[model samples]
Target: MINVFQPSLGEAEAAAVAEVFASNWTGRGPRTAAFEAEFAAHLGVPAEQLLFTNSCTSGLFLAVELLELGPGDEVVLPSVSFVAAANAVAAAGARPVFCDSDERTLNPTVAHVEAALTDRTRAVLVLHYGGRPGDIAGIAALCRERGLTLVEDAACAVASAVGETACGTFGDLASWSFDSMKTLVTGDGGALYVRDPELARRARQLAYYGLETASSLDAAGHSDRWWEPRVGGFGRRIVGNDVTAAIGSVQLRRLPDFVARRRELTELYDRLLAGVAGVRTPPTLPAGHRDSYYFYWVQLDPAIRDGVAADLLAADIYTTFRYPALHRVPIYGAGELTLPGAEAAADRTLLLPLHQGLTDAQAHTVVEALAGAVAGRAGAAPAGE
Candidate 1:
């Protein structure tokens, strides 16, 4: 079966892994440090500005913690995002305030987030959906106007851009995922980018369990040596590891090519299925915004989604619904939250076969199958058909 998500790891990745295996140091050390340096450089930031973590989730959790967000604090984010976005806030002892998104962009707009802000609102978490960058400048302006911190959840947005600025660099602190399914696969890894030196230092502290790294809490003002572990700070780093970074560096080198391939695939899908009935492809972003096209999401008319999905499955063409609405998930509990657009997207959005390795033929096959399935459903007569 053509899988919905596949990590396009080949000789390059295997070679990287083999190198790590050959080396005795598999913990978070040289390789991890190098990866962080390379990633920060890629983002046009100083090496000292980045922190590597186990997962984007951990990076986000660390961001929330560094900001001292707590039970009385409210963090605003789009309800349509990955549940991890909300969970990070909840994990930080902050309330997750859900907001509506722009239907056209499928992104949380600055106006919507601004409207959701309460007196308790502490930070704004913005996610770049489907690898398309959100309106970072507008959101940043809103955050500045309101004196709120901005945390970017850029798990799907590696290499994505809005105008000239990269998606992950717009917010005060941004988290990126290098999980197997993302554009950049690192086994299971993530990174954090910070614009502020002090916050960056604090984030490193939190990621390493509040350990007084030489760069962080060195009261002696020595730059080379770390102070002895203090009793109060969170002790021991849990997430950052070397093996993941070893794999990550290789993936990072290929990121530009992977992003280009996905965009090419998306263009091919748009062309192949342009006028197909009941198949609504999301619009391309304005030229200034470079969308990485991680998942080519389609909005199927409610009537045919299930049948079409089943047909694709039978044809050995895999597909997926990226996520269900946060409130709809049993774990989050069904609150009194009313988000119509998010609820509709949860019901109708379908992720077609999209990855760096998908060929033109495979993309066309899925589109053709989707059209056929929708047509077959339309022709069905009542329940007896």
Candidate 2:
């Protein structure tokens, strides 16, 4: 079966992990630090501004926590994003004000964010959906005007850019994912980029239980004061370790090739499904903007979406919806919120298999399957037949 999501890893990753195993020092040590530095360099950011975390969720939570928001504070974010963004705000004892998505981009625009703002709004969380860059400059301008903090949820946007400026660089703080299914697979790890040095330092300490720094042992590998460790304020153990960083370091080196292949496959899908009726491809990105193509989302008629997904599965081509509206989720207790664009996206959007491992022929097969499914539904009888 053609999977909707798949990770491509090979001997390079295995060799990296083997080196860590041989060293027998696989905790959060030298390898993790090296990975963080390399990743920061890749994004053209200073090493001092990056913080490595176990997952994008943790990075986002750290960003929210840095704001020191509480029950009275509200964070405006797209309701079509992964539930983690809202979960992070909720975890920080803040309210998440859901915003609608733009029909074309499937991402919340500056207008949508502006509409969601209330007197209690303290921050704006923008997600680059499917690795497609949103209108960050406009949103940043609005944030500046309102004196609001901008937190970028760039989990699917590693290496994505707008005119050479990376997506994570536009906000006060941003979180990037290198999970098993993302463009850069790190088993399960992420990084947080903070524009402020103090925030970056605090994030590092908070990730590791607020442990106080101390000097390294002597050259002889012996510590005269082994029991003199210092403790600081309360914190959580949400930092990445050397084991995962080992894998991530190798994956980072292959990110350019991975992104290229995914784009090639996506272009093939675009050409193959250009004329199919009842199916709409993702928005065409403007010039100077680049999408990482983490997922190739297509919008179908909401009434026939389920039928097409079932037909694709039966044909051995897996497909699934991208995201459900966050406000409708039971855990958030935001059912009363009305976000038409997000609700429309939740019902019509489906993710096609677009990864480095997918070949041109495989992409054609996926498009064929989708086209056939939609065509079959178009000619089907009415309900109760």
Candidate 3:
């Protein structure tokens, strides 16, 4: 079956893991530190500012906590966002203000964020939707003018950038996912970036039981009391281990090739699906916008959306929607909020299978199958009809 998401792994990854296993130490050791330095270089940041976490979700939670968000503080984010972003705000006793996204791009614009702003709002968390660096520069400027903190959920945007500036670096703090299905897979691990130097120091300490020092390696050569940790505050062990980093380093090295292939596939899909009836492709990126091509979504007539998905599945192709509108979620206490743009996009958008594992032949096959499915929809009207 053609999967909606897949990671490209091989003998190199296996060798990395084997090396980790051969070493006696595996928990947040030398390999983890080296990977952090490598990733920091990838994002063009100081190595000291980067910290590895167990997942991007943990990074979100850590970002929220670092900002000290609590009751009465609001975090404005797109309603069409990953559950982790909303949960991080909600779990911290802060309100997650859901905003509308552009119907075609499925990304909230600066105007969408402005409309959601209140005196109670403290921060703005924006996702680079489908790994497109959507309005992040504008939003960062907005946040600065308003004196609001910005946290970028760059989970889908590890390689995305505007020119040479990375997406995650646009905000005060950001999180990246390196999970099994992400562009750069590490089995299960993530990286966090804090812009402020002092805050970055605290971020690393806080990620690992709030210890004053980094790890045993620092004390190993300095003193006899190597095991005694100087507790800075109550924290948790959320640091990424060398076992995962070993694999991540290899994946990171191959990222450029992976992104190039995805870009090729994206253009191919665009050419093939351009004239397919009842289908609407995602909008093209503006100038200087480099998308990671994390998600290749197509919007269809809402009435026939489900039927088309069923047809695709029957043909042994797998597809799914991401990020149902968070405003409509009753748990967030904003179920009555009217976000026409987000609601519209949610009903019609469908993610097509686009990953490093997908070959050119498979991409053509996907479009062919999609075209056939849409054609088979007897009563399906063209998208706007």
Give the count of colliding residue pairs in each prediction: 1, 0, 0
Q: Write the per-residue lDDT of candidate 2 for residues 193-279, one digit (tens) a residue.
A: 999898888888778777665223422245566556555757788989898999999988999999999888888888888888988
Query: What do the candidate models score in CA lDDT, each in turn?
Result: 0.82, 0.87, 0.93
User: Which 10-residue window of candidate 1 scores lowest in summed lDDT?
Assistant: 223-232
- Tell me the tens digit of each residue's lDDT in model 1 across 46-83: 88889888889888877887788888899888888888
Estimate the lDDT of model 1: 0.82
RMSD of 3: 1.9
Please state every model's RMSD to the true fold in angstroms.
3.2, 2.3, 1.9
Ranking by lDDT: 3, 2, 1
Native-to-model Cα distance after best TM-score fit, residue 80 in candidate 3, in Å: 0.7
Q: Candidate 3 overall Cα lDDT vs. reference?
A: 0.93
Candidate 3 residue runs with Cα over 4 Å from true position: 216-226, 378-385
Candidate 3 per-residue C-alpha lDDT over 99-197 given as tens digits, one digit per residue, 9 for 90 to 100 = 999999988899999999999999999999989999999999999999999999999998999989999999899999999999999989899999999
List the lowest-lDDT window of 10 residues for candidate 3: 376-385
What lDDT score is found at residue 243 in candidate 1? 84
Residue 300, model 1, lDDT: 77
Pick the lDDT winner.
3
lDDT value, residue 334 of candidate 2: 83
